[model samples]
Target: MTDSDTGHSPVWARSKRRRSSGGGGGAFFGFLVFLLALFGAVVIGMSIKERSVAGGGAAIDGWIATGKASVMQAIGKAPAAADVAVEKAGDAAAATGDAVQAEAAQTADALKKQ
Candidate 1:
């Protein structure tokens, strides 16, 4: 029926043209987003590969690698430093035990002479 017959136009009779929102703003923004996503993927993948068994293989060995270091080199160094600290602590404990044994021996000898 016409709008004159009804109080107002029905939902199906409405002429609301939907604006196009499919286009990604423009080519520049679309490419920018693609590049950002690609860069992020590559960085994450390389960061993981850097710590893998096949990391920096003969293929990349010829490159000027600063010791096959990852971009997150500083983060990896923490474990190596902690290992060194543990080794030093073990050595110090062993040395302390030896000194205690020596002191005990000297005390025994002094008591025997008394």
Candidate 2:
């Protein structure tokens, strides 16, 4: 009998063909990788947003403190300014009285000479 008539084939002569069927585990693994990447992106975005909110809160606090300090400074200066204004007014009144007295003395001396 010819060698082909026997059911046995030599291992070196056997077909090494592969099937062209649907992608099995590789496609599922790729989909899992995509989901993991999406999850990572979401986590990063949330982290940035949280940091920004915290920073903004601190900045607002600083502005409020500055405004309070300015108001306190203005309040402290008000009484000093008032005291200076009162002193100046008293001085002006005294000067006006002295000028009137000097004019009366001049009129008396001129009448005595006449």
Candidate 3:
């Protein structure tokens, strides 16, 4: 049989056109909505992950670090200085008391010898 009579189609033949007119606009809008939803979902997921990373445990760590630094600073400044001052005062008082006791004992011994 001849090529035209065999009803065989060419590989490059154009396909049939669809009859719908407004389907393109609807498809475009649906795709746009899908993209917006996907973007929103991604943003929400990232925020949730970020929050978890910074939530109770992480917040507690930060507070603990701040407290530790504050304690270190307090230790570095006034309280330790006060402690040193108090120790020096105590040493001076004890030394003064010992000197007074020694003088009193010497005076008593001299009186007894006289």
Q: Pick the candidate with the highest TM-score.
A: 2
TM-score order of candidates, top first: 2, 1, 3
TM-score of model number 1: 0.37
How much lDDT does each candidate structure score? 0.72, 0.78, 0.77
lDDT of 3: 0.77
Model 2 worst lDDT run, 10 consecutive residues:
14-23
Candidate 3 has which clashing residue pairs, if any? none
* C-alpha-based local distance difference test score of model 2: 0.78
Estimate, for each residue in 1-114, the C-alpha lDDT of model 2 and write its tens digit.
Answer: 766799767665554322224446768888999999986675566557657655655655677899999999999999999999999999999999999999999999999999
- Model 3 Cα displacement at 44 (Å)? 44
TM-scores for all candidates: the values are: 0.37, 0.45, 0.35
Runs in model 2 with CA error above 4 Å?
1-51, 111-114
Q: Which of the two, 1 or 2, has more lDDT?
A: 2
For residues 1-114, what per-residue lDDT tens digits would candidate 1 score against the true structure? 788788887565554422244354666687999999986676566557787535634324535365556645977898999999999999999999999999999999999999
